[model samples]
Target: MPAFVGAIKINDISGSAVVNIGDVFHIEPRSQTKTFAGAGSFNTGNYLRVKNGYSVTHTVDADNVDNSNIGNT
Candidate 1:
């Protein structure tokens, strides 16, 4: 299964509920972190962590992530 970052969620074409990250489980593929500190360009981070059992933190590299705008494409 693919991982998610931030509050970005993935829904099937049927629009069914998938899963939500609650900072609990510390799921995988959390490197796709996109934070909006300001308004002007998107701030992309290469590292992301999910707290496992609210204790250990798991981190992974984004591996050349792209955050360019696509405007409706």
Candidate 2:
């Protein structure tokens, strides 16, 4: 098993796993990913550090936005 922070609720399909606000997901010393999950809002960031031998799949709520400043701004 792996270590995780924040909440992971069962039957909650519309959310990202293994990430939370102000928390940095470090895949390795040189690489890392961070996520900020806001309430009633969906904020997410996925940094691919390993660059190899890694795979992930998740469902995000439509209400969630990766970031407000990017893409739209």
Clashing pairs in 2: 42-64
* Model 1 error, position 33 (Å): 4.4
Q: How many pairs of residues collide in each model?
A: 0, 1
List model 2 lDDT by residue over 1-73, tens digit each. 4556576556653332443335455522322345543332343468633333444444454765443443321
Return the TM-score for candidate 2, rounded to 2 decimals: 0.14
What TM-score fits each model? 0.17, 0.14
What does candidate 1's lDDT look like per residue over 9-65, in tens digits? 565633332355554554334224444333323445767453334343334446665
Please estimate how well model 1 matches the true structure, expressed as its whole-model Cα lDDT.
0.44
Best by lDDT: 1
* lDDT score, candidate 2, position 23: 47
Candidate 2 Cα misplacement greater than 4 A, ranges: 1-56, 70-73
